[model samples]
Target: MEQLFFILLALLTLSAALMVVTTRNLLHAAFWLILVFFGIAGFFILLHAEFLAVVQVLIYIGAISTLIIFAIMLTRRIMDPQQPRFNSQWGLVGGLAALLFVVLAAVTTRVAWPTTSATLPAEPIKQLGADFVGVYAVPFEVASVLLVVAMIGAIIIARERG
Candidate 1:
């Protein structure tokens, strides 16, 4: 059952990711990227990392995807659908990509993966919550403030020239 879900999720994620790259419409590609982000959150759920799943959905799906879509929408004139998708150097790029893939595959296969048989913490969520609120509270709040400032800056920048 788990394997089936993993396979299906992998296929969905990969397909969406491929669509993100292959789609001629930039907006459509952004939507596909959202699907890809959701698929990643699904993977975190399947791994029993509930907090990670929620964060993935919140940070990637909610924040990043929204930002990307907003950026795409803001530059409306730039995403001309009739424009040619591929550049003249596409063939050279493809050859380099293929070579990189082969090298990465060979390196990965040759590496020795270390496996751990250790058990997970019984109340990991509670521990995480305590750690966050206790030790990481200040940093977390700082990050939130920075993100809010960045978002406001983006909004101002994205506003149409009057």
Candidate 2:
């Protein structure tokens, strides 16, 4: 059952990721990206990381996707259907992507990996809260500020569009 679920989730995630890159429609691509994020959250849930799963949904699907949607809405004029999706940089971009893929694959194959199962803390939620407030406080606050900035920027752009 778990294997089947994982395979299905992997397929869905890959399909959504491919759609995100291939779809010319910005809105459609954003929606597909949401699906990809959802699949990532599902993976976290499957790995028994409930805390991570909730954060993934809340941060990625709720916040980031919302931001992307807002940006899409604000930039309505640039989404011209008649515009060419692939520009003259297509060959260079494709070569760079291929090169990156090769490098990543080589690194992956060269690395010695451990196959041990993850052991979660007794109180994961509490530990997570403690970490956020104690160790990761600065980074967390920085992310919050970044989100606020992005929201403000989006609003500013949208207002200018009107």
Give candidate 1 misplaced runs (Cα > 4 Å).
133-162
Which 10-residue window in model 2 sums to the lowest lDDT? 153-162
lDDT (10s digit) by residue, model 1, range 1-162: 999999999999999998998799999999999999899999999888988999998989888889889888987986998887789998899789889989999999999989899888899899998988899999988989998998899779867798
How displaced is residue 34 in candidate 1, in Å? 0.9
| Per-residue lDDT of 59 in model 2 | 87
TM-score, one value per model: 0.80, 0.80
- Point out the worst 10-residue segment of candidate 1 by lDDT: 77-86
* Prediction 1 TM-score vs. true: 0.80
RMSD of 2: 2.9
Give the per-residue lDDT of model 2 (tens digit) for 1-162.
999999999999999998998788889999999999999999999988987899999989898899899888888976887777788898899899989999999999999988778676699889888999999999999999998998899778756453
Number of clashes in model 2? 0
